[model samples]
Target: MIKQIDKSNNLPSKISTISSIRMIFSYALLKKKEFILMLLFMGLGITFMMISPQISRRVINILENNDSNTSVNDILLPIGLGVLISLVGAIVLGIGRYFSAIVGTEAQYNIRKSVYNAINRQTFSFFNKAETGDLVARATSDIEMTTPVFNQGITLGFQSIIMMIGVVVGISITFPSISWIILLAVGLFLLAISFCAKRMQIAYVKSRKTFGNLTTVFRENIIGAQVVRIFNSQEKEIKKFRKENADFKDYTIEAIKWSTILRYSGWIMLAVMSSFVLIIGGWQAYVAYQNQDLSFDLGRFIAMLMYISMLGMPINQVNNVVMNFVQANAAMIRVKEVLDAMPEIMEDTNAISAENIRGDVEFRNVNFGYTSTLVLKNINLKVEAGTTIALLGTTGSGKSTLISLLPRFYDVVNGELLIDGVNIKKYKIEELRKQIAVCSQNIFLFNISIADNIRYGRPDASMNEVIQAA
Candidate 1:
């Protein structure tokens, strides 16, 4: 399915965005060496492409000479060489395609791994600020946007450019007098393309971002189905979904509309180019005949025409790659946003491991809040080993807030918290959390068997132990 991500409004800083994309592409290329091989094959195929046209010109000259010195073998030899080059080109192109696909898959795998690692290391605050659906989109959907760009765009896309250059250069060198017609047509097409492409790179990028936002909404609603159902907010959710869907549709339509225009416009340019080249070449051939320098090789013209026509495919591929890069550039911006984020909670590099310690906890004039809203007040408290202190308060009375401080979920606003006569912040977060477990009234089961739930506390627990806990 042609999933459209409409996000033409949220484009990021270009330098950072392009840097992120380059880094990913470079890494993916390294991981999949076959892509490099495919690139080499593409180069070979293009060289063959250039040779086909020249061979045609050669064959034409041979056949047209028809002098007593010329023989069928003369014509046959170049024809055979052209066919051989063509055969080799076809085989190499197939190999290049195979390698490209393999490399693309490998690149996707590496990108997914990098995104997964970044998501895993993200702090709770980051998650709270980011949508679950958005994160999932980055790991799954966004990575998908990059696959084609890496495989075809990074490898064959450049090869196609080289191929186009080879065709142009080959034609210019062989038939310089009439080449200007082709060049003129090319210049006009490029001008039209440049005008069409002016805002498209930016537009497609914006569209992709909108799609990400839409995916985030879809992800959140689906994952939080229970909340939506319990609240009976189906209508509200549907309305929101429809809105996002409409926005995506609009942006996608715009991108496709322009892209289609550019594509057809390019095709028109190619057609005009062909007619121009044919007319000018035909005239030149006539002039050469009058000057006794034109021995027309219809075979060479046919071959040259074929070579010129082949340019169309790579041109299309190049355009597609440009669009792909722009779209991936968008995804890269979103992905980098996560990778570049610095966690709010600080970690201790010099933390020490202390065993055989009592779990003594204390709070001294602690004050806390979420943003500007104070959730806790300045207060003093202490808890020694083996102490049983109950928090008595009505709902929203800061009991949960106070207890949360014990684990350093939120650092005190104006005071200090100590555990084992040491500042809680001094200990590594994981080490500190390991010493305490809060069994909430609402348990989150993993949809696994009962044994698994008990085993969650101790993954290495014995079956007997799990059974006993259950």
Candidate 2:
């Protein structure tokens, strides 16, 4: 059995978005050094991008104030420095992306592994209620959705904020009078992003659910193809699939619609920023020039334009980050639902060890059910050591359910099942299971060699034992 993490209380299906994101980060940050290195590289890369613009502004300023005191080297120096820093930004971004990929891949691997372990620990009732296809989608596609946060979502969001602050600060220091206008535009831009985030989250949640349903429908058709062929219902199955496919498409389009809104928000912010600089800031700078004040000049006004142009990249990046994170949060909710289900059988913490066993078994007034209604009721049976008994029953008569009780697959609800005269639940579950084996009615074979398949329940079985069993 996989060792389960007991720290986080398995929250319900309605788990909060921030909590889901926090859970995701817990998985991603497992490799401490890798996460730290990724942040370090990301900070360095964005720093270069930020400084380059400021240096380019200095070049424009030097040329605007050109005089006998200003040399050619003064003109060439800031220009060269700006270009050099831009190149460095590109290189640092490459390294940062490499580390981000490593962290993202590691996170995906860890989450997949943990989710698989959680599934293995689930009881038989879990499979009875869960669609195979829906579970498969959650384990694969939904988990894949969480990965973009590490890849582009986190870095892009951080970069966007840093750049926004840089632009506002640059604008404030250069043209302080109209800095408030720039701040207001940025504030509006953030409000638009926040509005879009709520819409995207709703759309993503619906889309992921519809996709799971669609997957379930498709998997059912494929797995039951023989039944469909026997009943000549292929057309009916195809029609059902098409309906589900349409639902998936509609929900996906809804999500895309919200993403488009976010993209347009960035564009709208850019337009507003440009208008403020070219129109409002222009008037302020003219007044300053008329007053013969050197605090704000035409070159500095041009620098404000440069900052406006630079703000576009972070705006677009923020759009992507919001979309990625909101979608990822929706996916995380689906994944968390699987981990939150309660199993029927929990091994007793104070159970006795099951060592060498006599083959005696007994079921005493046993009443059991997978749900509220009992499938097996008021049953009493006993078998002595070295004796065998056959269970004779019609279909749906609980014969399989009775046999399933011995292995504790589903615990008996209202009676005692004993092995060797001691209550089975009193024995340590692992050791108790190791003492008994049953050949189930449902015949399922794994994709492996025949000998391996024969000895699957006992992987340590020798070749002779496997051959004899086969």
Candidate 3:
């Protein structure tokens, strides 16, 4: 599971656009109540933000137009109102984030559960192809990568857009002519971000591939630790570990490098944009003062500066989300592959349940192979109820392979296998497997009492039966 962290650092590689991330998040956060709560709080916060500039301008104007006729209560009243509004905004923002986290946690839980359940249902053949460590990575690390997408992506993504739009609206309503420069700067910044986002996606994919390879190595070393010790190959294993570790480090550094570039680039863009605003704002302020026109109020100019200043946080947040999505894309792809898989074995139409069984089994003229080479050829066998048949074969002579075939571990390539005269494929897999009891040379033991391990064969078997099996 620790291996997922290495892969997680490579998350941003998969997402192509912010919209893609948003859509993915929406699907993940399926619960309506959680979604509504998150949105409600989010709306409150952004609404407060949009109105904040106007309130600040109001306060400034009150202070500027001081007169004996106007009581001190007039200024104090607006100041108090602004402060109260800000307080409510802060509270709403806090609540919104808290609920967003809850939604994300629940959403990730469902995703992880589904991934684990799907993997568990897969046949032994599936494990033969998929690494145990990779499964762990998907369930743990991959599921975790979706958390931010569920939480921040929806709430923060929307809030950023609202804030940007709200600021633009304020500027347009107040000073129509100067609003063009602000809009233009925002558009240019978005274009640059989009270009960098493309490169981030590419880097993110490479990082995920590297992480998968790294996870494979980690899993192999752990599972085969005893084998390495017995063979006196500790040095070899260590060297291999070092190589994988180095590769993981390199990929992680590459991922972080791109995120860093995006983050800093956004900051620099905002800085440049701010400089432009200052130059233009200062010019406008100067012109209004020289012309003795009340069009450009000092109060409104100061408020505009504050609004643009506040835009910095949302801009940075947007950039951060883009980078996070890049790293998470690998997780999404891995998870999607599992979700989209078509099971090799599926129940036949019109399948019926049997109420009784005598445990008679037959394999007639069955030919089978695993992957490339043939393992069973022209095999014919029958086992009646209560029959004790001894299977004797040389190593790799298909004793284990033949036993495996009985449970349909690997289906026969040709011919028929029947249990109680019905074709094995026609019977439900679980029903067929339940009738057989297998005791191999290698017995699997869970982390439980000896009695429990025996009971695993027959989950509802009596204590006496379990003891007898052991």
Candidate 4:
């Protein structure tokens, strides 16, 4: 089965150049020698790219001379050289892509693992604030969005920049007269791209955000299918999903419009610039032909045109890199949000660890609340060892919140909670939780054998023990 991530709307947050560069290098997770080699191969591949146009120019010049004295070998020599250069370029570029693929895949794995671990360490309260579906999207789809962008967009994007520089230098050395036209057109293209890109990015962000909402809707519908049927509100749920899906489509179309404008405008500028250069070069060649100077000849004019074409060659690729970069940055930000989360409950370094806990629980003048408005207040309670106690309260009366305190999920805002006359704060968080057994109201069963599920919390328990527990 092939899985495809629809990242059309899965776009980016702001990508600050410096921070993003730093993040890229860090997340790339390549060893120094390997990273250096990847860059070397990409550079060598770009160097070979520069040679092809020059070879074409040389071959054109030789052919244009129209001299009987020029041998067949002379014509074949540059053509042969061009073919050889192409072969070498292919090898180095292939090697570069190979290295990029490995690194990209590895980086994606590390990020996914890190995000999963982060989510696991979070307090139960964290999930109440963050959408479970959005977090899932960040781990899967968002993490996935960065891999290809890194491999194709970032790696090739680097080479594209180098190629652009090569084109500039090649033009300056070979045809300085028309270099300004290429340069001017390029300048305008950049300015125009910059002006429009912000809106494009925003649209992409909206699109991806809607997709996250879509995921949430799907998850809720599936998980709450029983409740939906019980209420006979399946149609309402379907409508909600459709509305979110439509919003995603609309946002994606808006993003496509912006990207299309940027992409096609580049080609248009290249066309206009090529024409302008040709007209000016034609005028110069005509004067030279009339004067019989033979300085600005057909060969040089043809070479100039080839140089212009080469300059425009990488524009499409560079544009693609730019779009990929924006999408990846958006993903990076969401993933970063997960990595940056600090668990509300923390284990204290100096806390004591108990191998065995005596069952004596007391809440002394406890006052607690998720916020300033207290859900629990001024409580005094004790439950002795081997005694069974029940907490009976009306809804919103903090029954669940009070039980949650036993595991140190949230600390009381005031007063002490004691286990065996020892303040719970002094107990190691792990040791404290291990001493208690909790069965949540919303239960989940792992898809495993009954015996396995019975001993999940105590994997060492024998089958006899598992049967007894079950």
Candidate with maximal lDDT = 2
TM-scores of all predicted structures: 0.89, 0.92, 0.90, 0.91
Q: Each model's number of backbone clashes?
A: 11, 0, 9, 2
Candidate 2 structure quality by residue, lDDT tens digits, 1-470: 21122222232234467778888788768877877777787778777876765676777788777677999998898888888888988898888778778878888898899889889889887888787888898899999898779776876777688778888888888778778888888888788888877767776777777778789988888888899899999889889888878877876787798789879977987897688668887787788888987776566677777777888898888888888888899888888777776666888889998887786999999999877999999989999988977988899999889988998888889989998899898888888888788888788889998888898989999999998887
lDDT of each: 0.74, 0.81, 0.74, 0.79
Where in model 4 is the C-alpha error above 4 Å? Answer: 1-22, 29-32, 66-71
Best by TM-score: 2
How would you encode candidate 4's per-residue C-alpha lDDT over 372-430 as one tens digit per residue? Answer: 88888898999998999798888878898999998999888999999989888889988
In model 3, the Cα lDDT at residue 66 comes to 68
For candidate 3, lDDT tens digit of each residue in 265-303? 778877887898889889988898899877568788888
* Candidate 2: residue 180 lDDT (0-100): 86
Residue pairs of candidate 3 with colliding backbone atoms:
11-326, 11-327, 11-328, 12-326, 12-327, 12-328, 13-204, 13-326, 13-327
Lowest-sum lDDT 10-residue window in model 1? 1-10
Candidate 3, number of clashes:
9
